[model samples]
Target: MTTWTYAELAPDFRYWLREGLPVGLPGVVAVSLDGGGHYARRFEDAPPALTVEATDFLLPLQPPVLYGDAQGLAVRLTDTGRAFDDCEVVFQAESPGFMLWTIHTGPLADANHVVRVPALPDGRAIRMISGVEVTCIENRDFADPTRPERTAVGASRR
Candidate 1:
């Protein structure tokens, strides 16, 4: 299994945080890591300064079920018909184990979108994205520990 250290991803994470991500949405910030790890935050209504509330996880990497990017390393879950209009689902692998994904809905669209990240089968922890420090936690920490039989050991997984 490949072990990932924060030192490797710190630069990219800091860069993303400083640039405010590449998201086109006005008040949404979304990021995903490899092994089914995804994070998203949407502000209620429209606020000048956004306070992010996020939900994230680490799960086994699954097949591309929805949308695949040009290189086939990224996949999205949004409908191809109204991708940019309503909501956006995106998952891109930055490197081998370093990946990021996003799901953003427009300001006028329904904000109740549900993102389900499968559980980590090896009982390891996944890293959380932060501007100042690097943090890692297990799937059981979130109060839900539904695990699979196999796990994908990415760079972020210890």
Candidate 2:
């Protein structure tokens, strides 16, 4: 399974996320696709692909919170543009309610994000006020097999 430490996103990422810039955080997001299905092992396997890459952004948040059972991050877009097209994650289950924890990003949403995170409280969804327009969610199964924790946000390591 995957084990990691909780670190904040880089300063630039945090800024975009907070300000709602859609250009996306500038950086290379790499994950393993193969090798043995173990810790940091996906860097090897291909084809049936052990790694997945995406144009990732740092969603905004006030401050992060880690519940006794789980941890979560929330963000809203600064740019008032088209809604998100689609978001895909590695923990494949068709919809939001499987073994994978869920993050919800949508339109005209206020930090009044109780609908998506019905399991949690309304104030629980992370939020930021900025220039662009977007919504972002990041959920964690604190004890899952695939959360990327090795990457550092800025030049500094926490």
**lDDT of each model, Cα atoms only?**
0.30, 0.26
Write one digit per residue (lDDT tens) for candidate 2, span 57-153. Answer: 2323222221222344332222233222222111122122333433434332233222222334443433322222222322222122244322111
Query: 99, model 2: CA deviation in Å?
Result: 1.5
Tens-place lDDT digits, model 1, residues 28-109:
3334444334343432233344332222333332222332233232222322221112333444432335646443434213
Please give the distance, in angstroms, between residue 141's alpha carbon in candidate 2 and its true position after superposition: 26
Cα-based TM-score, every candidate:
0.20, 0.19
Worst 10 residues of 2 by lDDT: 149-158
